[model samples]
Target: MQETAVNVLHPLKTAALAAMLVLATGWSAVAATPPDQLLVGMNMNNVLTLDPASATGNDVVPVAANLYDYVVELDLHDPTQVRPGIAESWSIADDRRSIVFRIRSGVKFHLGNPLTAEDVAWSLARTLKINRALASPWKAYGFSAANVERSIEATDASTLTIHLPRPTDPRLVLYTLATSIGAVVLDRKTVLAHEHNGDHGAQWLTTHSAGSGAYALARWRPEDVMLLTRFDGYWRGPAKLRAVVLRHIPESQSLRLMIDRNDLDVAMGMSAPDLNALRHDPNVAVETVASGSMYYVALSMSDPKFADRRVREAIRNLIDYDGINRTIMPNYGVFHQRPVQSALPASLPDPGYALNVAAARKLLAEAGFPDGFKTTIRVLADPPFMNIATSLQSTLAQAGIQAEVLSGTGNQVYGAMRNRDFQIVVGRGGGGMEPDPYSNLRALVYNPDNAASAKLTNFQGWRTSFSDPQINRLIERAERERDGAEQIRLYQQVQQRYDADVGPIFPISQMTNTVVLAKDVHGYFVSPAWTTRLRDVYKQR
Candidate 1:
């Protein structure tokens, strides 16, 4: 692969020209990037919005994390541990229906506005009012627009209290506050100042920011570049790097070439092959972290064919789990067949589903499809997804099932899944942002209503049109259970029931994110929740 130069000038010639120009005109060299600025290359195709109440996908997590501050944060090294952020300390009521957080003093937003408990309360209430993608968790906890104002209130200037409308485990709510972007505290005064038509500043916030964090938004051009400048007055102190430049480069080979030419300090979304090639380079270091998400093939039960339990079981048997994990998922993911992530204690082991063409054919015949049928597999036209779809197509063909691969951007693929308009989709999702088992189960398996009019697009279970009353009951019961041992037992039972009923969403692997960075870049911690903060990242000269 040939390196793509940012300009027409060669490195040495550019350096010499810069020196001559500096001597003649008193100007700094433009050929090399400054040590104080961190250059990052990543795929930003899915970053549709910056509004914390509406943004979806992992691409927006890092951006929101730096521009906003959550009340609490999960530890980078140990995600199970929750640490204070804007809130110094918090207490839960004995009834587990309410919790109060004490906001730290002297925190200031980017615009020099004071951060107070009112901002925290209003920020959370705004999510429920807007009822966008991020509001799903809050809604699941039984908080809605009707009761948000009374339920979440500012007891004082520094104390914010949240009263649950329904019974739930307070720990889960605390985890949500720590991990969800919707929970980020916004400057109430600033946001209301920009409010247009009573949107609560949703429109203005898409291109602007109002939060107390280590960095402030400098500039953002969708699908092109995002710039974050350090905030000197940040409560935790200024970030080590003066600025962060994130460039959206989708092609894996182009990212590889840029990294090799010392043009990019970090590269994300590289293919498995590109990652392998860079693994042995002394100038670059590869870092991998286990994300809480999962990679799976979902069968839409809305289709009559997939509605049959026999057909769903047959399709599960047709997947090449071992082959796909060994060949296509080196740095992408690991073999995991359960819905919950492996880090949770309630998670169950893989049920050992493997490719058995004979068994699948028998099951298909029993389902009244003696000669199999034709279908389409919708997938993103990127690494791992496309590779997984291609492998699945070949395996399904072995059982006399003719399958066609339809690949498009993340929007086209996942958008179709969200609308319940796809036959099958190879995608990645789950509620792994929090360490609790309820997070994954709620996102992946619990579906309260199956009507098309319900439009619960955020839940994968509802999107797949797969729901079991028994599984739903178990999941809800587990979430409200206070006893740790009883909760684990209930979660384990839910997984067993899901497997026995042949759920439509088949989990093949647990997702893992890998990034290649320049050796001199230090303190870059890859977070499992996708909330990676650049506050501590520094370049060693």
Candidate 2:
């Protein structure tokens, strides 16, 4: 909920508050935090890049979430819906292209500069300009380096306006803005001052932070540790915790041991068995929540023989969802078919695609594979991905299809799929972390453009050259629909239409993030994106 001022605070009022604070605490800014703070365990080895424009991994999302604020944000209570953040209020025009945002007055960066429309415009321009690997998620929304500078502009200091080339679904724009990349509003003065030889202060940002948020980046040493201190002038108020320490203890056993000894407050990144054991410990609490991410088995449409519609339907029928959900994913996952989770709007029913060996065999026979055929599917090097692959192999063997499971690192597996060097593969990814269903569908299933222009690295449908003229039209229509209810109806129609064709991918589960923390710790939701800012957490004391 927003707490509005009667009007902008007068300069004298701000000065009086500061004077009162100094008189009461003998400090000008804030009281010093106690030495002991909340410690959170997470992996930071992959966090080399600090520029939000170039950030594309889970490693940097949590870091940026605390270090910056976007124009709008997703509500903590209902993440799929929109909430106001830095921009206290905003409005859209009748033409639908012009979006006017009013900056929250009196907000200051951690480095002591007021946030303004200039900073918001500059940061967005930077993201579009650096549109490389980092801009992958928004690429589907038709945003590109070629057009962003002309589209997003600041009308004045307090009024920032964005002009789209065409009507973009309002929720799509808002939800997209709520993400890490869209929220990277830096301190214009501080960042510009640190600019070295046109680096846009990227070199400095890798080690220092210049933004306004609940926490400030205190220290960052690659592969070691990252610490965040509560912002002395945080707009909301002081954070509950004194500080948040993300220690890079690589081993799950080391994390477990440290938390058990009270040297740490959380033990993250552990395997299911480790968590299962920890759940029984009197001092530990394991919590699991459904996430937007999904795992699926996708077939390569480039394989002409496998192109038969019957083959696709048969593969969907052959998957033993019950077997996998019960044995392999007790705490890690839940059955899911739609690209988006049920938590979001317009999620279609499961379509009741279940295990039916007889039906699968019948389809295979119709497709001239009565005797069954051998095929190969790729999976990540991890045990879970491999376990799911092996299980599928056994089930497929029942229908006379001899399947081989190739294992390797995620890059290796996804690379093979992207390169079209594999027949089929089991993969996990969904909105990168945003729960926006349009974003997920665009990346996973929509491919109106040809493979060359598809930027198919993350587009699973394009990875297999799976395309449909009808699906593309429906996607475009849904992207421009103004009414939310109409948009949901269009999306549901798209989902059912694609399912009717037995789309190249068969979704098996919606990933459930399972985290284990100390019993006395009160932490916020561990989002589907697998990143959470620790400002809302505290120790019971």
Candidate 3:
């Protein structure tokens, strides 16, 4: 009665009613609109270098990680897990040496060109050609004289395959390929257009960017500030915030004051003490993530002052990791109780090495350096390690060693360390999407084949002549093993050997960084391994 006979049996009316229902469903399909603005601050100046292959420094990696995307992505929620990013899917040959990948559909570079397999081939070739100055995470996948053949070829527009001389394990694919430094896919046509200008990976991409990432560099000045804006043309949904602004605040106290005043939305590379103070404020939020990195003293193996094993052991024993953690690092980090060979979570047999003065002295005496030698230690001007370095110098002095502490900017410190200009240098090393022992170990151990190997602790240019046949064999086997369990085992063995040898690195601490952001931010995840993914991160209303 209320429906007034319900317009009974009218087919046209029924059709109209159905059409209205369909319209409502379509309306619900619309996506939520993104935010208007997003901002962040940093304690130190970011290099603001856009070239992923050559970008170095703690501040630079966090920014490039989000502004750039790789073909394969390591799952943030699960450090060991991985998913496809630019490439849709991949498969290995029967021998497991060659891999064929089917490019994802609808992917486009920042320049609006569709992504193709030829771009993949070009990207790999570019990385091999440049062999970037920065030690990338991908160098571990057996990128040797043999692996440098640019073995990549595009079978077709969407199909690409890479032929490895030896059968590579499937698990080794992502570990060796998923690097922050190498092969960030670009538009083949855009690169070709610039090829005549002598620009390719790092050298070409430095001032500009052309990846399919969430944002693009809108503006950048080396010593000033850099700006990033959401890529409206992104194949993935547009980022929530309209833009990201990176300020270069070289002074820690100034940065702290800025954040406290609410002038900064987020800050990058905050020191442990300043971070702790921010976390205590009720109005501010602090987020600490385990940085997938390890800081060590790089001994000049080629230097005459540190040439003896006794001297190196003496230096290692002289470091007071426990005291440093209590004072400098405070609540922000753990005393490197375990000798960190590789950053693998489970691979560490123990959290750190014990401070054994007796063992250290014995080793020193055996090497004919019972009276300890005099040397200098170089370090960054940053405060987090200022107290630690001073303590190290004092401890070495007690051992009849003259330890002169020299402070300088990051660039100066890096240059000194690379050229073996100092007897010992305090530095941190870890990068790329995946943290492999190869990444950490290679930096400390010199590999004759690696171009960067000369700068690493293992290089012939450095002091310690420490070598282990078992470790070398394991490194070769680990590179070949595709099976996860076997690979882990091989790495564990490497760790054990490293522990026994107790070479150049006297690893003292593994840091837990507190990262603070506005409550409206989403997709922020930090791994204990110290990996931060900027791609999936966005702001919410």
Candidate 4:
């Protein structure tokens, strides 16, 4: 409940040496010297928001993950599985309305303070108050300020019980933990200490961190770098890496050069071309994994010009996804996966918007615009999306639809999407190991309130009503079903609806996060949670 104790200058020289022996001779025959250090690189600097409860941007998620610990841990080996982190094991009541967890004993925060039941209660409460800005997954779990307290109680320092409003499915709990938003726990006092700045824990978390994880934040200077040191007193065990340094390099060229020059161990946010080129090099071992994320061109359904189904369809048909796939994401496989799967209620069916000039022309004529109309498209200035946007701009020209490409950062594009300022724009949506399409759809398409809060849903401006009752019911059903099979079925049902509808947006492939590691490093776990479990990882001979 209180902030974890912070101990400085603790040495693990003896333990590290022992670990080296176990790694080399104990398990194998030939013993070799381990590399002294490991280096990693990322495109942008951390969001400078370290509070596990309040941080958002992907840039911060990785680092925050390193510094924080969660009670309900997700099983990366099995996306649907939920494992205990702070808690040792848990049980669900026969009625399924209450779940109880037996907290793991002997656990201490990075600050050296012991973890307790009170802390668990405080962390959950903090999540509810922070809501979407801090952790959308908290809301997804159906947790509310009132419902939380009435349902949650700490039986003891090592025990916690949660009572739900009604007997709901256990699957919801499982999915919720599958997200970083839910997995990120907070230090009660540290979070509460910032209550005056705002109700949310964002203000306090930005500068301070007191988690019970394997690493501690030694220094975090926004725009410059973030430095992390292994927490020797970690409950699980001492981390293998002595330190982690993350530097911000916004320019793709600079990042690539650095990686190629061996100045960096990892480079994130590279374009497909550059990534593909790296894959071919013998010295650079490149690998990609599926990320449950998607990039798409969202058109404002609220706009008068785009309000008509035919007009929306005409514009959709004009999109050349294949052309962009060929020119821009060449290394990426065809048949891009949507950010949201078809199963979610908010999903739109592809508008059958392929590269059919004749069909686009016909649809335009039927929409009473015999001459193709012109529209401006806002896009992120970054590569891949920007390049794809330009390709779209050129493709639309074929259909006599004049398209102007406007470039900006994520914030600017997001702002435009919420306001419906531009006719269309390109953006990405992801996060959550098993996102269950609704995560993407509800946030982007269905929620009317989302249209106003660019902060809530970037594609919320669209008032388009999709007539798919089956999917609508399934969405509700999936949310309640505790059985994995039933949820999967419900997901399939929604996906079918999406295939039939052919909405404006399309699916891109799920991306696997790729990172380079020094040869000395061993035992690293790369999770869909997008965070590295550096505790057991270590340098080897």
Candidate 5:
């Protein structure tokens, strides 16, 4: 099959075309997107790097899913269930200290190199050696550069074994393997050939790909466009589409207009207003799925004001959860006040926290701030963050507290939070991509260290300088609990304790991702873990 390059119109050119069409024909032009190709539109600001070991944001999940393959995959409808991928099957050791995988035969990488167990072993070992952002989960599970070589190994061409260095639920390790981008198997030979200095191909893999997946990297221009061509020798059948082109069109209005005119097939990251407007259109279909993440308001406990439990409770009371979910979060998120995503059986129901100005004032008075105090709220300049910050500003004023909204890019807002420099922040994050309570707790609540020099930036609890021995004990105990029922109970207890202790991070809502697709598109189901695959997506006309 011959590969085709799909032309993506520049945003300005698209607007000019619309204006010309309106003036000439009294209507906009409806250009049919190519039947053999898929065009996606979304904001690419967060897609800073494509190297799986370093990629840290949701924007890179779907891209990496199509470019590489994992040993196992989480079921689309039920993430708790694991499905076989590169590894045909795997078995846990009798003592639950190791897992052995049986690598499949005849799998070929995009570069035509044969896939082997050595590739799987090297890929995971490299992830630890690099020790970047994506290595957090592995490090949490006691895997490190010093022990990774001995802990993970290929016994033969078709067999790989991974030994655990600590006591923890083996299932959590499997879940991490199934969902984490770092676990994607790389073509070791191809990658090492491109290695520069002692970087181990870290620099080359940023803009390139060497995997046994449905698509191969064709061209990538950060903040502009990415093109992927179908890999004919993919272990699975070749992708239905000849090529997939992802365009970076940050403006929601432009995406709305393009999809309306049939110039684009799929649009993501659209504003709620545009999604609501497209709901009644017959040619377009608006779909939503529960994303395993939360929208939260975090406070830095290092600040003397927030260190007081009474003041922390007062700030939590000032949030208008119901109003925000009902109005501002219509298409953005749903009301959820717990750290864990609501889909998990281990998760508890919302604790019914509403805007209580009177209660907030009383708590403030008890905390010796009868007149309230002034603070700044750091938030992303995007849709829901800014909107949530504005709502918080209004409610806080009612409680006599003055707050200024500080808006910036993801790096600006999150960087300040990571450095323990922000007073308050309206952000959306928690490692709920995997369907496990521990994933959420480890990211939001489990802080093993509280010292400034520890720099556990990956853990939100550490970032906020909030640590409780009781909460930490519960999280650790829950992870090691072998009894299913007891594990659930422990997770529930952690949430209850967090509420009573007035933890700094307060979850306001659970995220629900919405996408606008042309009606003719089929087999485009969104993954709750953000690993949406495009191998089977095709256009009818």
Candidate 6:
């Protein structure tokens, strides 16, 4: 790959630029900003709204995390370890039917209201009220619209208790709380103040935030920029950086240019080519960590040919996993077909599907498409997936299956997937919010309640209308199983069954997401869930 010009953030650049501006104009210019600021570049289009209840993509996780606090949170460095947030300590009942938290005292929302148990209860209620987006995962935990008021209660000023509708493991309850939007606390007084027509301020929250986090929202102009300022009164000390500015630049080369010129601090959401070109630049430190998401080709089982089990197996064999991982996804992806990410337990190894054109052709003939047929694939207009989709198109053609690739933003692509509007599509999405098997198993495979009311989540199974009553029974049994050993055994059984019958073609797990930053910046690591925290991050300057 050709090398790119990448440089560290120059401490004197602000002054130098200011001097030039002063020289150009007759009047004096504003003083240069202090070096204690961070500018992040990413595809901010995924963040259409900041309402934690409605946040759908991990693309906005880092941003939302800065402005909100969860009752319990996943340890950023290690998701398996649950950590405290607004709630300093928590305890579960002996019967495993209720959990109570001791809300941290003196923690103030950005609006100046001190943290209270009511805020904690109201936050979860808000997501339940919205009945969409991040609220979808709660249904698996026994949360439903009808049980909202009865299930959640603020017992005291600093005590919040939740009663489960069904018996569940305490770990499962904490796991859900650690999600990006799951246990997020909202200011009850502030949100209620903006309520109109029983909307619970869902409309107002789309553009504003009312939380007690390290940083607070300043302004957000969709598709342009989101500006945030440090909250000095944060319960967990103030942020090291004074401000965080997120710029929306879809072009990878443009982001690289900004990094090269020291105009940007960190550049995320860049393509593989742009990142590969910066690998050797001394001033640019690229941090890549394996993520919890998978890249796969989802087939609409509604298609008569795809409905055949033989055809689905043959399509799996047609993928060039080794070739794609070695050449196309170096430093960014790993071959993984198991529904769950390897970091989590019960995730099985690849079932050994090699690229065999003849075998695929035979399977195609068995499915009644002897000579193959034409189809279309929807894909995000970004790297790796788009490039991989093109490769798939080539491989499928060899088996006499002609395919056309359509490119668009994630909303356009995934929207089609959710609507079940396409025959096939190269997509990337899965549950990685917590370090557990069910988050992925339930979202990608189990769909016993796959109905219009359950569309709150983008469970791929719903799109294909795939469900197995046996698998659903196992999933619930596993959730209710309290014994650690027994729980693992049950989840592994769920994985085994899913691999044998599921129609989606999960080819690889994204190995690492690259976040390029100036070498002097510290405390930014690749996220397990594609998210980062700015509280500990600081510039050498």
Instruction: Choose the strongest candidate by TM-score.
Output: 5
Candidate 1 lDDT tens digits, 202-280: 9888777777777777566677766677788899988998777788889999889878877788899998999999999
**What residue runs in model 6 are displaced by over 4 Å at the alpha carbon?**
1-33, 449-457
TM-score for candidate 2, residues paired by index: 0.87
Report per-prediction Cα RMSD to one decimal: 5.6, 7.9, 12.0, 6.5, 5.3, 6.0
Q: Per-residue lDDT of 1-541 in model 2, one digit per residue for the tens?
A: 2211111111224564344323222211333222246666766666766677766656577778877777887766667777788888889888787778898888888877999998998888777666655566555556677887667778888988878766676666777678756456888888788799887777766667777887876555566666666776878876886566677766777777766766667666677777778889988788887767778888988887568889988988889887888787767679887776666787877877788999999999999999899899899866568888998999999899999888987678888877877888988876745676677788777877646555566677788778888988888898888788998898888898889878888888887777787777886667665546666787775
lDDT-based ranking: 5, 1, 6, 2, 4, 3
- Looking at model 3, residue 133 earns an lDDT score of 52
TM-score of each: 0.93, 0.87, 0.82, 0.84, 0.94, 0.90
Clashes of each: 0, 0, 29, 26, 0, 1
As for lDDT, the candidate ahead, 1 or 2, is: 1
Local accuracy of candidate 5 as per-residue lDDT tens digits, 88-202: 9999987889999999999988777899999999999999999987888899999999999999999999999999998888898888888899999998998999899989898
Q: Give the least accurate 10-residue stretch of model 6, judged by summed lDDT.
A: 2-11
**Angstrom error at residue 459, model 1:** 1.8
Pull out the clashing pairs in model 2.
none
Model 6 whole-model lDDT (C-alpha atoms): 0.76
Model 3 scores a C-alpha lDDT of 0.61
lDDT of each: 0.87, 0.74, 0.61, 0.62, 0.87, 0.76
Give per-residue CA lDDT, model 4, range 350-399, as digits (tens).
43336787888898888888887879888888767788788778877887
Q: Which residue runs of candidate 3 sit more than 4 Å off their true CA positions?
A: 1-35, 43-48, 134-150, 167-169, 201-204, 303-307, 331-333, 337-346, 356-370, 430-433, 446-466, 482-486, 527-541
> Relative to the unseen true structure, what is the C-alpha lDDT of residue 417 in candidate 4, on a scale of 0 to 100?
62
Q: What lDDT does candidate 4 reach at residue 249?
A: 68
